[model samples]
Target: MGKSTGFMEYKRVDENSGAVKDRIKNFNEFHKHLNEDDRIKQAARCMDCGVPMCQAAIRLKGMVTGCPLHNLIPEWNDEIYQGHYEHALSRLLKTSNFPEFTGRVCPALCEKACICGTVEDAVTIHNNELFLIEKGFEEGYMKPRIPAIRSGKKVAVVGSGPSGLAVADQLNRRGHSVTVYERDDRIGGLLMYGIPNMKLQKEVIIRRQKLMEAEGVVFRTSVDVGVDIKAADLLKEYDAVVLSCGAKNPRPLAAADMKNTKGIYYAVDFLKSTTKAIIASGALLQDKVTLTNAKEGSYISAKDKNVVIVGGGDTGNDCVGTCIRHGASSVTQIEMMPCPPVERSASNPWPEWPKVLKTDYGQEEAIGVYGHDPRIYETTVKEVISKNGKILAVKTVKVKFDNGKLVEVPGTESTLKCDLLLIAAGFIGCQEYVAKDFGVALSKRNTVATSDPDVYTTGVKKVFTAGDMHRGQSLVVWAIAEGRACAKQVDEYLMGYSNM
Candidate 1:
């Protein structure tokens, strides 16, 4: 309530992104932050309602709503409205350890739950958050807040993704020594490989890691816990162990045809290779790099190739953008589910997250270059056709849901010429190696089994699990929440009290 009538006077204004033509040329962040006055104006849109739903992480129809970290959005929005940037930042960090990461990558559950969004556009909470943290960093107000005392306890965090980082940060701040182990060469597990640099700059993650280092969090890279080291070794050497290894075992399409194609690849491998090339040589667009160990001889250049991406989610859209930027002749994305309505339906009411047709960053970039939306609704690949062990085309068919199962609709069969086939289906759960090695019982779904909601312990003693390992694949905010909550459980197990 900075200006009594500020909400009435101001319209929601988000930060402007860089021009698509220039941005897609390189793998880098392009979302420009709003200036001081502009950001305050945007923040003024928050009414700071009496019953702020944005702070409540509720669920409706089995889907999550509001901030998963349970951030005090209205409180911080009011702070930003009054031009209290530092205060807003302080309030933000109370729950979220990495606002910068969430600010860039999160789909913003808080915005959907904003009271202002019931009937109108929501407050620009996400943009304002980005502005506040970026300003904090630029003004030299951001630094590592090292713990004042040591509890003489050591904690081992398996995985360096959002959840693992959040757990280590909180545990370290609670006067415990924390060490994070990552299987990747870089510290960021998924952020380094699963995500593209253009959306979330790898440098942003590295910068945060440096701050955590100064705060006395030790990071070990390229060393797997279950393989290189043993789970029993960790339990004996460390006081507590928290697992945040993400759900990344991809679900493969069941097909009996068995084209045995060479060009068919998992979406994760493509994204990982693309990011590696970009980081290794500062090459992102159209440039070809050959891996010595590439089983498929020579790289499948997206340049002048007809590419069909099977899946219409963020990962599929990422492939679309990357291929277009890589000089693909044409691109098409197909989703098995029917296309969503352009607007929220009658069943969906205010203060609930609206699921509607919205163009994401990658889709927008693809449309800018390719002249049309690349997605095809209600379609799935029937079979991949290859010649001489090389992918050439794919047969697709329109599908309809019948009793919750996909059934092919007759007379809709079609063949799409495709030189490359990328399957962006989805993940199953956490990798089985570590969980099996530790003898920790997993749920039928393969996620680390937790007997209680808040308690993170598994069947194995002194072993705890969090993030995707426990909760399955989810948003970044959920990962952070799991990490924070999991650390509290670990604290209770070690010191006989849970101050964290």
Candidate 2:
């Protein structure tokens, strides 16, 4: 601990963010870093307790708490408090492969499980982490670590998302030749498109990609394994293959005539198209400008239209932000479940992933522009009102749970003007084409199925899987953890021993 009594002396100080009104004008990161002095004070708040739950990845009451990567939170907090910037960064990188990515986007499970937060505000673990990694880059400490000798083994990573990137980074550093294949025109699979540019800038992903390339990881964009490149060909050429394809099979809406409606789109498609347009524009995105449409031959635009997004999770929140940035006249988000309590419920005690209501940046921006939170809790889409095959409005109904079944309440039906409807109801599983092509069996959850009692390996030899493809839809931090563990197993299979 930097100072034993520092937790008592200093209070938590979060990183400052730009006002929502000013931030919504452009699609860029708006959260500003804390000054060095204040960052130190925030880090000093870490008590370095003997039982530091911040880094303890534990499962309780069916919910995961703390950092899944099991990061050395106390060690790094002390390093930051003592002004040992490089040491702090080293300690951070020991567990996380992409602290920069997690820093910007992760929900910060570490803070939720923090012992300090049990009584008071938690230490600024997430902000301190962002500061350390960015400091590493600024001070030129983050450089390519090319392997000195070749291991004479080759590995193919069948995705460019977080998990695939982690596998490639780890395997390449271990002297194995690794090549990452992505179907999209650019790398950083979900990171590049699924997430909006306002939350995580495209340049950050590209910067890391360039560094990975410099370190001798080959990236093949627009190459879809099992389609553009045959799965059999990969197995014949490389010693091993790791499938990290994310779970992108979107859950369908049961709205009447939803399929034929011209203004309907998946939440991923909407968010992806907006990011692509923003990146292609080379500046802040403008209203009604079309880049590559999410669906072939169909353009998605929300400018001056009343948009209704289905789902109240992060993806829907992203859609809310994107449509607002596109100048949508009005926006509303619908959730099937009841709104969570403002604070943690008695059933959800400390260190069990606090189930509290959070006003995210998108909600804040929506409230600033529309003068109210756009979410309609305990409600769901009932139908898609359309005319001439175009969406004109959305019908919704309030719902309640009875006998563990969702039942729509009577006399609570309403309709809202909706020129655009985005389905953000979450993913069901991985797309079927790739899994079928690879001859991999699937579990009941529609995820890639491995041999009995053995994960990461398919029934077919020399084939492995990770990330959402293996574990179903999960957090990016979990994807990286899965990738690291899968890489270690793959290394052991190849060399009969491993140190990845």
* Predicted structure with the largest TM-score when compared to the true one: 2
Which ten residues in a row are the worst by lDDT in model 2? 288-297
**Model 2 lDDT tens row, 313-409:** 8889999988888789999999998889999888999989988898888888899999999999999888888889998988899999999999999
With candidate 1 superimposed using the best TM-score fit, by how many Å does residue 32's alpha carbon deviate from the native?
2.1
- lDDT values of the candidates? 0.83, 0.88
Cα TM-score of candidate 2: 0.96
- Predicted candidate 1 versus true structure: per-residue lDDT over 143-204, tens digit per residue: 88988899999999999999999999999999999999999988877777888777787778
* Candidate 2 Cα outliers beyond 4 Å, as residue runs: 256-258, 284-299, 451-454
Q: Would you give me the overall lDDT of model 1?
A: 0.83
TM-score of each: 0.95, 0.96
Clashes of each: 0, 0
Error of 1 at 78 (Å): 1.8
